[model samples]
Target chain A: MRRAGVVALNTFREAVRDRVLYNLVFFALLMMAAAVAVGQISIGIEQTVIVSLGLSAISLIGLLISVFIGVALVSKEMDKRTLHALLANPVRRWEFLLGKFAGLVLTLAVNTAAMALGLLLVMIYVKHSLERSDAVVLVAVYFILLKLALIVALALLFSCFTTPLLAILFTVGFYIVGLYVQELRNLPVEVMSPAMTAFTKGLSYLLPNFENFNVMAMAAHGRAVPGALILQNTVYTVVYCTIVLTAAAAVFSRRNLK
Target chain B: MPGLAIEIENLTKEYPFGFLHLKKKTSLEGLNMQVETGEVFGFIGPNGAGKSTTIKLLMRLIFPTAGSARILGKPISDVEMHRDIGYLPEQPYFYDYLTAAELLDYFARFHDLTAADRKERVERMLKKVGLETARKIQLRKYSKGMLQRVGLAQAILHDPKIVILDEPMSGLDPVGRREVRDIILELKREGKTVMFSTHILSDAEMLCDRVGVIVGGKLRGVGAPGTLVDMKTQGMEILFELRGTSNAPLLSKATRTGDCYRLQVAEEELYAAIDQLRAAGARILSVAQVKATLEEFFTNLVEADGTHTSAVEVSGK
Candidate 1:
């Protein structure tokens, strides 16, 4: 456990120093600034529109950052042959994988916190006041963090078998596809035979309904978010992230690094 | 056998490539060798001779297609053996953004060293490799020689029982090479098994207790350099300086004869061979048998292989 923590810390430091992290920060800041402009065109929900757009920007940029950075973790190590140093030591492969994932998640958390603070400042400046329930911005940030954690796991798993570029592409593709699980489920089963319908339904059940966890539209309209719904979304995100993480660990355990 | 640092039996690696293009090549054929504890073993080979592949196999960076390699009598597939080994690859790379101290400390932690212990070990290793003064400098600013020195320091920092170095002296100049050589000797003095792969025969000739020559993925020879160079052939000859005149007849009578060369035994023989000597040796110096040098032995091996390689190849081009 101590060794894993060390590896994690090393990975975190490496990731934090990556140029890509700076670019993500810049993009997040741009989005927070853009929310101010987006607030002027709001139909009615001035503060709501600003906060929702800011939350969406954070989530989207966080997804890109996680996928982009996470996929390259193993490939970059292999490319530079730094992995040899790690392998020559007592570090386990599973430990290395977990450490990278944890480190990246930490980066995302830090990035999310920054975005949330930026959005909060903007909301206060634009409205001259803030809603007490605007703490849901924190909710939105937590949800985005959880979702990015899952993306990190996906990127890591793909990294074991593919190049960094391909891993990122596949991971981002999966993220986009995961969001359309509702549409995939709402497809016309009557047109298809029972077998095809069952297949489609099975895939829908298997893929995460990223849409289900999206409370941006409701939060933007000032609808009350029940504790039960947050709980369900949190549980789903945790379970999905765990499943992907386990798969990544399995693949990495057998990964051959030369 | 119990003290053997590494043991291998028919280890092999076959990398499959070009599945879509309908071609594939096996990188490593069946290779078998072993190194004992506290030995400075040299794995010498030409380029693409499976030296790096063998190191990779022993490190378990890749799974073998067949056979087994054991470290400390435990299969290398076991994670426990890693703590006992340190490896320096041919191209040792690090995060360029990190200072040398940070990189060393980061690696030290993987072995569960405490902060104080890691600092001490890192400092000791850095100083031993002469990188302590530059510890705060980012690795990107380091020269190739400095990078190699840093690599050496990290590889030996934990004082592993076995240290595997692949072409560790490739980019070093004379001074750097000597420093690394001294470090390797020091490791051997401390009873650590040091197995390093190299194409430079001089390094092996000077540093190795046993050297294995590999070519085209086969173990051509394995033994001390002196023994390998001495095992091939032997020859003897004699020369005489007469008082006033040519002693052709007397010399022929005293010298040995064989089908390869015959002794000239008369004035007539001298007269006939005089023209040959005039054409070959304008001034005849004293002739004597000279024992073949190690250089000659190595050249003979490469020449005998029938590749028609140039002299540079023999000199590790």
Candidate 2:
């Protein structure tokens, strides 16, 4: 575990030094500024517009950062041959895999927090006072972070076995499919055969249900997220990330690395 | 066995290829060898002769399909045994974003070194590798030779008992190569076991206590560099300057270059040739015996293996 921390710290340092976080955070802030400008043109719904736009900006930028950087995490190491010297040390393969996952998630969390802070400052400037409803925006940002963490896990799992380009495609594919998993579950059973229904139902259960993490609508309407949903999202993200990361470690351990 | 630093028995590795990995290619086959403690062992081979493959398997960067190896009596699967082992891969590429100091410090943390110990060791290693001046610069900005130096620095930062290096002298200038050779010698003087792989035969001849010649996914020979080749004299060569050129007896057989003539004679004919040259009033410049070299021995092994394919052939395949 201590070795994992060392690898994680080095990985986080790599991302920070690469200046990837800076570009994405700057873009998110720019979008929030644009939201502020758009808020002024609207009448009596400035908070709603700002909350909706700010959270959307955070989610979009977070998704991009998560998917791109996460996929490169292991593949780039192997491509650059950095893993050759690293694994020669006493570090376990699973520890290295988990460390990379944790490092990217830490980067995402930092970027999301920076973007969320920018959103809060925008709210303060426009409203001239802090409102209790604005606290819900923080919860919505937290949920977006959970979604990004899940994406990082998926990207890492794909990265273990495929090229970065294919990993990116697979991660985005899973994310898009995962968003519509509830619809897949609710397909009309009257029109479909029993086998098709069972297949779709199994897929719905197997795929990550990302829809559950969407709290932006509730935040834009200034409605508080229920406590139960927050608990569910936290547990779901933990369990899902564990399974994906375990599979990643297993694949990476057996890889030839030639 | 108690004095052995490394031991291998029937170790083999096969890589799967083709669609769905149904077809397999053998990369290393039935390798068995051992290195005594405190001895410098050189693994010499040509390109694609399984030198790097064997080293990678020992480092656990890849797994073997058959057999097993042990380092310091611990099986290769024992992770704890790695603490006493240091490895540098061929053409080692480090995290380019990190400075030399930062990279060494990061690697040291894995050895559980404390802050002060890491700082001291990082500084010492940088100086040892002659990269102290460039320690603060990021690896991306470093030249290949400088990067090789950094690779060496990181490998020995923890001061392990055994060091395994694959092509450590690659990308180094002549002076850099000499410096690395000195480092390896110094490590041996300190009673550390060092195993390095190289295609450069002269380096092996100079520094290795013993060498293993590998070809065609198999080890062909293992012995001391001096004993691996034929010790019998191949012939004798004499360099002489005929004073006044009085039609020396062997002058017709000698090759002339400006002021000197050189002749090769069988070992039994050496003294007779010298007496004849003296009778002809010739001044002998030097006399030397020619012997078979490690390079010739290594080439013979490669040829005997019948797998010495050209680079173009390998690439096309």
True contacts kept of each: 0.84, 0.86
Weakest lDDT window of 10 consecutive positions for candidate 2 chain A: A23-32
User: Can you write out model 1's per-residue Cα lDDT over B112-131, one digit (the tens) per residue?
Assistant: 78789999999999999998
Per-candidate DockQ values are 0.69, 0.85
| Candidate 2 CAPRI classification by DockQ | high
How is the predicted docking of candidate 1 categorized under the CAPRI scheme?
Answer: medium
Report model 2's interface C-alpha RMSD after superposition on the true interface residues.
0.7
RMSD of each: 6.0, 2.3
Which ranges of candidate 1 are over 4 A from the true structure? A19-44, B20-24, B236-317
| Candidate 2 C-alpha lDDT tens digits along B272-317 | 9999998998899999987778998888777776765742133133
Question: If you score just chain A, what TM-score does every candidate get?
Answer: 0.90, 0.96
